[model samples]
Target chain A: MIRAIRSELLKVRTTSLWWLILIGVVAFTAVAIAFNMLATYVTIHPGTVGPQQGGPDSLLTSVTGLYTSGQYAGTLLAMVFGILIFTNEFFHQTATATFLATPKRTLVIGAKLIVAVIVGVVIALITTVLAVGSGLIFLSTQHADLYLGNAEVLKSIGLNWLAFAIWAVFGLGIGALLRSQILSVILGLVAMLIGQTVVQVVLALLSSYFHVKWLMKIAYYLPSSASSIMTSPHGADGFEWWAGALILLAYGAVAAVIGTVITRQRDIS
Target chain B: MADGQIVVTGLTKQFRKVRAVDNLSFTVQPGRVTGFLGPNGAGKTTTLRMLLGLVTATSGTATIGGRRYVDLPDPLRIVGAGLEASSFHKGRTGRDHLRVLCAAAGLPANRADHALEMVGLTPAAKRKVKGYSLGMKQRLGIAAGMLGDPQVLIFDEPANGLDPEGIRWMRTLLSSFADQGRTVLVSSHLLSEVQLFADDVVIIAAGKLIRQGPVEELTNLDGAARQIRVVTPEPDKLFGALELPRTAVAKDENGGFLVTGVTGPQIGKAALAAGVELHELAPQRADLEKVFLELTSGKAGIR
Candidate 1:
């Protein structure tokens, strides 16, 4: 198992995918920060205060505004990275060598999961730090009393960054289940963008006819819905942040097991 | 571990309705190059994959060094395999590819460089596999196979895209591995190539073992009739003189006599006794290619 992990790390380090993902994350985060900064500058210049009033709100006006956009971009970035991690093997025929070297399919899947989680956390942390730091600079220019060290602001930032890790695992699960980059990415996008809308519409229509509000509550525990809950300031009702994390972890576990089983049974040709 | 003995017993693999490998049983002994020969779609690759645990067999067992590949403590150190084309990531450098495999096999880091040099790819080791030619990629595959210096090596068409020189190098390398008391199993459709390197030949056809024996034993005529071609001034006299029951004489394309079912020495003695000047008396023994075709043909009941 250790050897498999070491080999997986070596592959991740040498491939160009890692660099491409890093550049992508940094670029998207920077653009998100710039857009938020521009919006804050326009709203706060000429000594005009925004509607929101508070140390956290005034200090993080730019960052708070960029959160929605940054989170979306981060999810997409993680999905691409995750898809490439598995699909690249199929595309390049590297999986044959990989399996032949290890032969224990579960070990390989475990190693991939470890690498994906680590990469996900690192990218998430970097993007959040850059966005927050840039937002603070813009706030300073406006002479707003924003406190970066405030408990609420720190909690939001830390939780939001941690959300990246969960989303990364979720993306890994999707990639494993689908096994193709294009298919996995399309499925991930539809699940992220339209799954919630469809579920909400169904929930609204069925709430009057049936007393099964638990169905919608369960939907909130899905990786996509739960991830939003983790990042949002006000957590969803009946679903705490820790519960959402557990749901995402469960999804990852199920995916890893299924992927390992299929891989072990199938031919590597 | 079985200590370099590959014992495959009743190994069977099926793909839906198709039986890719059926009840395949063979033992690849140590200290020899065991040639796995078959026609296209004859399940050679499938068998090799099952042996390496890359593909799970539907039933039976294929164990290397007396243990299933997945069960081996240090599999790569016990068995090394090079299957299919360029299994490395196209974007990764050859050096990094070998390094990753070395790490997986628990071999020392320096083995990667030594393997590259062994396959004569040390100079191109740093280049990405995407830029490598087919032959170079094959060389890198060979390098990867040798990384752990395993006791048993399995190669599937390792000389597929190689030039004559490369093929010679591969033949020598494989033979040397066997000479060092390692078991080498190579699968190829090219009978001529295997003729040069293989010490024992296991021929399969239609997912069944057709024949298995030493190359020379399969080709040599132990008791079978041998063809003796002869050119003589008088064809009729030569034909009448050679009145053997199995002997048949026909007119050659050059207006000479083509004699069959008689040895060269028998023909020469007959010609001398009949006062006929023998222009040519050439004995034709069956070659491996002929024997392989005959054995693999559908009429044979091996399948």
Candidate 2:
């Protein structure tokens, strides 16, 4: 198992995927922070700037919410990293060599899972630092009060890290279940970005038509909703903190089980 | 009883509506090179994959050293396989590709370099696989397979893109591997090449075993069935006189009388008795190429 893990790490290190993903982290975080800084600057110097639509409260909200909104981009990078871990093997036909070297397919999958989590944590931490550093510099320049040590700020950062970790593992599970590199990445991004939103909107419209609140409650239990609950500030009409965590955990558990079973019986060809 | 023996028993694989391999069975003994021959779509790759535990067999078993591949504690140390020459990530360097396998097998890192050197790929080890030609990729695959220095080695079309010199090098490497008491099973469509070094031959067609035996025995099984060509000025009289029971007689494109199922001495005697002046009389030896064509052509059922 240790050897397999080492092999997986070596594979990731030798490829260019890591550098591409890190670039994504820097670009996404920088853009989000830049937008927040622009908003803060506009709020403080209203005389020099044209008439603004919103007040400082809204500006502050977007500024502080960089940890949540900006993290979405960072976690997506982690998710891509996870997807490539298995898809690259399938696309390159290296899976044959991989399975031949270690006939126990489960060990290979396990090693990939381990690497995914480690990469997830490291990427999440790096992006968080970027957001925090940029937020500090920008907000301080605008003479705005930056709550660097606030409980809510810290909670949001920690949960965002957890979110990235879960998303990475989730990507691995999806990759294993669907071995196509293009399809897995596309479907995964769709589910994260649009599928859940479409579901919530359709459910809300249906609930309004039927005059039933329970129909809307079903959205709260979805994997996306659980993730939003953890990554978003406060709560959004879903399970409490621990319950949301458990639901997200359940997704990971199910994905892991199904993915492992499918891969074990699958032919490398 | 050899340590690297491979025993496949009644191995079968059905891919949905098509039976890719049908009750195929063959054994590869240590200290010998076994050539697995088959036509296109003949299930050679499928069978090798099954043996390596990459694909699940529908029925029967393929074992190396009396144990299934999945049951082996460290499979790479016991069995090394190059099932496809292009089974590599084009983005990775050749050295890193072998290094990954070495790590999995728990071998020293230098083994990757050593194997590359053995395959004459040490100079190109630092280059990415994407830049390699087909022959270079084949050498890299062989280097990866030999990284662990396993007791058993299996290759599927290992000479697909190799030049004649590279093919000869591969042949020498495989022979040396077998000479060291290791087992080597290679599948190829090149009959003449397999004839060069194969001690045992296992032939398959339509996913079924057609024939298998020592190379010499299979080629020289029935001397009477060997072909004989007689070029003579009196083609009609020679053809008529050469007629015999169980003999297939036909006129060659060059107006020569071709006879099968009769010894060259018998043809000579009949020609002398008939007073047919023969310009040239020669026996066509049954070689691996002829046997392969005959067996696969479905003309004569050798198995």
Interface-residue RMSD per candidate?
1.1, 0.7
lDDT of 2 by residue, B35-153 (tens): 99988788889999999999999999999999999898888888888878778888899999999988887888999999999888889999999999999989988888888789999
Best by DockQ: 2
Highest-lDDT candidate = 2
Error of 1 at A119 (Å): 0.5
DockQ (Cα-based) for each candidate: 0.75, 0.84
lDDT of each: 0.79, 0.84
User: Where does model 1 exceed 4 Å of error?
Assistant: A39-69, A194-222, B221-225, B243-259, B299-303
Q: At residue B169, what lDDT does model 2 achieve?
A: 89
Candidate 1 vs. truth: CA RMSD? 3.2
lDDT of 1 by residue, B114-218 (tens): 999999998998899889999999899888888888899999989899999999999999999999999999999989999989999999887888888888788
